[model samples]
Structures are given as structure tokens and as C-alpha cells.
Target: MKKLLILGLLFSTGLFQACTVNENPQPITNELLAEVFEVKADFTPGNSFRNYYNLSPVIFDSDVLLVYEFVGLDKTGADIWKPLPQIYTSDNGIHQYNFDFTKLDFSIFLDANFDRMRLNNSWRLGKTFRVVIVPGKFAKMVDKNNLQNVMNTLKLTESSVVDLTI
Candidate 1:
């Protein structure tokens, strides 16, 4: 018992010494974090079905614009991805885009292997607009098994209406 107690005490002391908290913890400012990419989808009847062939198909459609924002983060909550400046468009309604970290004029935290992406913000505007994140191929690459699960966990459906000029 005496030997065990001594060994445990020595191990604990060494562990505590090695893991010291930062006395002056640096704040994670917006500059340190990467910009979030904003994806916009226009649900116009004529043009909606056109852009679908190149990327993914448009599963749902309404007379509205659906916008979603997302950024990458590390396990410890550090920003790992940067947002791209220009928004991408598709001829068909079903369009997909990502935050190109390489194009952003900032340093990235995560490498290429970690393809996990998320929707941090979303919004819609129309007579009756509703935004939803449907499970797609991106789910398999996410940390969670289900893409819908991540959307539900993050509450991606929560959205706001914006005023737009016709």
C-alpha cells in the first residue's frame, strides 16, 4: 500500500507539472478564426433544374433564396478553415460550394485529410421560405455518421428572413 501510494503521488505530481494552464490565455479573435463560406441557392423555376447536372440534384424547390454559412474548427475549438471571397453558382438549382482555404489570404489550422464541414449560419427570404439540411454524400466524410444528425445537433434549420430588392 505504501509503495502504491508513493508511485501514484509521484505520477500525479509530474502530470500536473507538465499540464500547466496558460497564465495569460490569448483570446481567439475573428482574425485568428477563418471566414465562413456562404452558399446561396436560388429556387427559380426555370433556372433551378439546370445547375443540377454538374454537381448534385435539387431535392427541394421554392420561390426563394436559401443561404448557408459554414467554417471549419479543430477539436479544441480553434478555427481551422478560411472562407472564400466569391460565391459559386450553378446553372441548375442543386448547387454545392465550399470554403476554399487555399484561396483565402490567411493561414489554415487543419490539413487536407480532415474534410469535416459544418453550417454555422443560415437564412431565407420569400413568401414562404423554409431552410433544411438534407443528408447527402458529405455525411460520410463528416465526423458524425449521419449528416442529418449533425444538422439536427447544430440546429441548422434555425433561420431568419431578410429583405431583398426585386
Candidate 2:
């Protein structure tokens, strides 16, 4: 009986020790989880040609980049943010604001059916853009087209935005 009791106690002790959780665990840091940046482009000299903007902290190849351009104010006096690949039509021609990104950098350019130089200042100059870095883990869950949806899912707000424009 004594031998059995000792063996049972030993087994119980080992099991409990194995199940113990680490109390002073290191923090789980994923800096690229969801980061926001506000960038401004004048598109002066680059407007006539091609230009690329480098992302400050390089992102992982698995990460996703989302870009939004500030279009204008709404009726409620609130600023409107529109997703990129935006197209504009006017007398000048059909103009598009498109962008491409790699793990190291991202670039925005004006694409038009007409002369690129003919694009109006409104379409080229003084543009504010929001760049969001989302971890690839959440890529499938996010609606990339809807800015509001992306912001909501990532729990990001204007307060969380880092102003790279300055």
C-alpha cells in the first residue's frame, strides 16, 4: 500500500509540474501586425515621371500593403479616404492613380490615356495618402477595398496613424 501511494503521489506531482504555466513569459511582439502611416506627395517633378517611396521599416514578404488617398471632404465636413487605383474622367482624359509595392518600397503614379503631363493639379499635387501594413495572417479576413472595413478589423483609428508626411 505504501509503495502504491508513493508512486501515485510522484505521478501526480509530475503531471502538475508539467501543466504549470510560465509566469514571467516574454511579451509576444509582432510590430508588423497592423501599422498605419499618413504620407503626403506633392508629385511635382515626379508627376512628370516615375517615383517610388520607400517604406521606413521594411515589411515581410508575407505582409500586405494597403494604400488610401484623401479625396475630399464630405457633406458632414468629415474627410473622405478612398482606396487607391482611383480613376478620374474629365476633358483632359481618363486619369488613374495607381500604386505598386514590394517588401522594401511602394510607389504611386499617374496613369492616363492622354498625356501624363496634362493631368490637373487636383489629381497630381498635394495628395495625402494612408498606407497600412497588415500582417499576412489577417490578409484573407480583411476587405482590402473598403477602407472602413480594414480600419475596423485592424482596430486602427486616426490616433494610431503615424504621420510620415512630416
Candidate 3:
């Protein structure tokens, strides 16, 4: 009985010692930076000229892609140009890429009017920009504010806005 009790206690202690959590989550030490790029002209509608922008997280395995589009319009609600599709890449914890709009080609440009203009500039549009973090590696969507806080704390820039004019 005494031996069994001692063995049980020793096993319990060993199990507890082995079950440890990471007290300090690893910090993103590498300097991560994103640059604004133009999308290829081929992807633009009607081969219309437009401007594009993107923000990529610096950390590898970030899996996040933040994309933005800017279209040039004429006075008559006609699109003179539109942004092209952008691409992003994630390695380990860092993300990086540029949207090359100047190289893409496309068909007709989408019409942009008063109300539509406002809708195009909303957060919903911003949400289209996303990082592809691993399934369990990223914070929950509800914790987006916290994630922003984390970025701020790490001194990481969120993203830059691009301007398009006709």
C-alpha cells in the first residue's frame, strides 16, 4: 500500500510538471513591412487604367491578405479605370506581397456613382482585406480589435490607402 501511494504521487507530480503552458507567447521580433503596389493592367476591366494598394503583415505564417482597389471615374458615372486583383503570401509568421495592377487586363469597368462610391469606401470593403493566418493560429474575428491592439503594440502598420483619379 505504501509503495503504491508513493508511485501514484510521483506519477502525478511528473504529469503536472510535464503539462506546462507557454507563459510568454513568442513576440514578432523581425521587422515586417508592407509596400503599396499597382495591379497588373491585364486584370483591369476593359483594359481600363486604375490604381491598387495592399497591406501585407510582416510576420511569416500570418496568412493574412489585405487588398484595396481604387477606380477612376468620369463625370458621367462611367468608370475610366479600375483596380486589378492583388496577391499576398505568408511564410511562417510573416506576410508579404504587392498588388501589381499595372500588369493585369480585364473587361468593362464597374460604374461608380454617388451612393455606390460611399459603399465602395466602407469598412466592409476594408474587411475584404484579410490575412490568412492558420486556422488555430490567429485570433478570433471578434478579437479583431485586440489583434489591432497587438499590431499597434508591436509597432506594425495596418495598411495604406491608395488614391485613384480619372
Candidate 4:
């Protein structure tokens, strides 16, 4: 009877020693699960025939591509919008590139006689641009210049607009 009691006590002691309690436990945090990016573009007025601008991806993954577009009216007297030729940049974080405004080609994006070269003039100043990030896989499968396709790839859930100028 004494031996059995000692063995039971030892077994209970072992079980108690084997138990564990978490220490300094950190609470689990839930963040939105999605592909995200931070985009930036600086439009600087240069000359009538050319301009200089800085384009960059502030926060993005290497497997993604950044598409920059020039958005404005389709024509001088038209209400329609036209997305000008798209410029693509790699996924280097916070890397800025200077593109010669003189090299801008609008053969496909603009209507005939819509002079894109003149966009560097003072009248065309203060234009705010946008950037869209797309997966490299989508870059190969879809046209990055198309906003719809980029939205699809980004899995856009919601969007909001804010007017800071006001």
C-alpha cells in the first residue's frame, strides 16, 4: 500500500512538472490580407518641348510592376477622359527615375492632332498623377495600362477620395 501510494504521488508530480503555461504571451493581431503598395509621382514643369518628372514606388514588392499614366481630357473640347501612354518601372523600393518629356510617345494613346508634346506648357501644369501596382504574373497575362485589369489583379475592395486642396 505504501509503495503504490508513492508511485502514484511520483506520477502525479511528473505530470505536474510536464505541464506548461505560456509566459509573456502576445495577443494576435489581425491585419488586412491583401497586396498593397505606396505610389508617388512628382510633376515638374520644364519647357514647352520637354519636361522632367520623378516617378517612384515608395512601398512595393519585387514581384510587382508599377504603371504610371498621364490622365487628362481626351481633347480640347471633349468631355471624355484619355489615359495617355503608360510608363512602367521595376519594383525597386523608393527608387526614382527621370524620364525625358521629349521621349513621350502618344501615337496609340492620343487622337491625331492632339499634341502631347505641348503638355509641358504652363497651362498643363499642376497635374496630379496616379500609380497602380500589379503582380508580375498579371503583368505578363494582362495589359498593365488597363486600369480595370490592374484593379482585378490588385483585388480592390474599396476606395475613397479626399480633396486636400479644399
Candidate 5:
């Protein structure tokens, strides 16, 4: 019993020593983090914007990849919001995408891929989105291959709105 207790104590001590938290974890640097891409979508007639959102492409310099998603229609209660999908700004230089409002015909598109939903130009006057821009390498770092992490990262953006004049 004495020998067993000593061995158990030694083993537990070694185990506790092995479990150490990184006191000085790596800091998020300018390289790891980039300027958040800002997009401002507005309401346009379904007939008018039948093809695509006619807004200027929100471009970034030296920004390798961009990530974003549709936040919601309004900022209040009962707000139609969900983290169903994420929008990759580009694997190419296409940080800008042609927002297709006409896709609202199929609600599943919005449910499955929330970022692709086009603003209901007929029913809703306008819609909003929150975009996060990160270099390709850091994209995975931010999300950690988890939707909840991506969702948490999005909360960093206080609010989302579309500025048509953008």
C-alpha cells in the first residue's frame, strides 16, 4: 500500500507538470489580421437589379482572401438572422461579388447559404451584411474549422449596413 501510494503520487505529479497553459501565446499580428472589408448593400427594385448588385467592388490592397456573410435585414427583435453560410470573398482577386437579389425566390438558398441571399427588393426596402477580411493563412486560424468560431468572430463587427454609394 505504501509503495502503491508513492507511485500514484509520483505519477499524478508528473501528469500535472505535463499539463501547462501557454503563458505567452502568440499574438495576432498585422500580418495575421488585415483590415476588415466593408460592404454596404442597399435595396433596389427586383426589376431594376434583376441581374446583380450594381455597386462598386469593395477592393482591398494586398488582401489575399476575404470572408463575410449576410448579417440580417434589421437590427431589432424578430430579426431574420442565421449563421447558415459563409461567403468567401475570393480565392481569386474577386473580393467583389455581384449580389443577386433575385435568389430570394428560393428560401433554401438563404437557409443553406445565408450569405448568398439577395435582398427582397419587393418586400424589404434594404438589407445588411457583415464582412470579415483576412489573409488566406489566417482565415482558417480565425474560424478553427468551426462555425461557432466564425459566428463569434462576426460579433466583432458591431453592426452591418449597406452603403449604396460605396
Candidate 6:
């Protein structure tokens, strides 16, 4: 019994020693952090009903793109962003806001169950969007549908976003 007690004590001590806390723990930093951009543009639905924009600095093939629409301002007057493909049911029918991206560029478009022309012209003009480029590995770790979750996980804020006009 005494031998067992000593063995357990030694094992506990070893475990405690192995878990050393750093006196001045360094802040965790990622060299390949995500990038964010705010794009303000108009979607001219001609024959195809799509508008494409080029990525200034080409992203990696493994990187994933998340696009959000600026719905409006909140009660606090802060901009409200919602992840796409967002769907809305109007009096006419259901309309959706969505996007697709490659390593070089991305396109945003509107689709509806009803005739898309029936939708208000305002829906296609003067639209704001937020684009997030996340590393493929990081995307798997967060709720991609949650803008706040992705922003927090990527350590990005509105101030850090680069603005582009299209």
C-alpha cells in the first residue's frame, strides 16, 4: 500500500511538472490570417443576370470564399451583414442573393422563382457586400453561415476590411 501511494505521488508530480505555464504567454498569432473586403456595386442583370469581379491579389486554390450582403442598419445604426445565399419571399415570389468564386474572381447574382424582372430595380442597384477569404483549413473550424463567428475566428473587424468599388 505504501509503495502504491509513493508511485501515485511521483506520477502526479510528473504530470504537474509537465504542465508548465508560461510566465509571459505570447499572444497566438496566425501568419496566414483571413482577408476581408467590402464591395459596393450594382448588379446589372442583362442576358445572364450575373456580375463578376476580379480578386486583386489572387487567393490560393485551397482558400474558400464567403459572401455576405449588407441588409441594412441595426437599431444602433451599425451596419447589419447577413451571409448568403440569402432568400427572401416577396409578394411576387422567392428571390435569392448568392455568389460563386474561383481563385481569380467571384460573381454575384440574383435568382427568383418568379420572373426576376418583377423584382424591384432597387434590389439590383446600389448593393453592398462583404467578401471573406478564409483559408480552407480555418473554414472547417467555424460556422461558415455565421458572419460574426467567421469574423471572430478570423480576428477580423469592420475597420480591417478593404473597400472596393465595382
Top candidate when judged by TM-score against the true structure: 2
After superposing candidate 4 on the true structure, give the runs of residues whose Cα lies further than 4 Å from its correct spot.
1-42, 45-61, 73-123, 157-166
lDDT of 4 by residue, 125-149 (tens): 3433333434444557655555555
* Clash pairs for candidate 5: 40-162, 40-163, 41-162
- By TM-score, the candidates rank as 2, 6, 4, 5, 3, 1
Query: Model 4: which residue pairs collide?
Result: none
**Of the pair 1 and 3, which is ahead by lDDT?**
3
Per-residue alpha-carbon lDDT of candidate 3 for residues 62-162, written as tens digits (9 for 90 to 100): 33333333334469964332222432222322221223222121121223222223332331122222222222243343233233333443344435323
Candidate 2 local Cα displacement, residue 135, angstroms: 0.7
lDDT of each: 0.31, 0.80, 0.34, 0.38, 0.39, 0.84
Off by over 4 Å in 3: 29-37, 43-66, 72-166
Q: Count the backbone clashes (under 3 Å) in each candidate.
A: 5, 0, 35, 0, 3, 0
Between candidates 1 and 2, name the one with more favorable TM-score. Answer: 2
The lDDT of model 2 is: 0.80
Report the lDDT tens digits of candidate 5 across residue range 31-108.
Answer: 234433334444334433222332123324433333233444455543343332333332222112223222111011
TM-score of each: 0.22, 0.76, 0.31, 0.35, 0.33, 0.75
lDDT of 1 at 79: 34
- Position 50, candidate 6: lDDT: 73
Query: Which predicted model would earn the best lDDT?
Result: 6
Task: Give the range of the ten consecutive residues with the poorest summed lDDT in model 3.
Answer: 101-110
Tens digit per residue, CA lDDT, model 6, 1-166 = 9999999999999999999787998765543558888887665556366778898688889899999999988899977888989999989989888999999999988888888877787887778899999987797898987777888899887787889876
lDDT, residue 68, candidate 6: 92
TM-score of decoy 1: 0.22
Off by over 4 Å in 1: 31-45, 49-166
Stretches of model 2 off by over 4 angstroms after superposition: 1-32, 45-49
lDDT preference between candidates 2 and 5, better one: 2
TM-score: the better of candidates 1 and 5 = 5
Worst 10 residues of 4 by lDDT: 102-111
Q: By the TM-score metric, which is better: model 3 or model 4?
A: 4
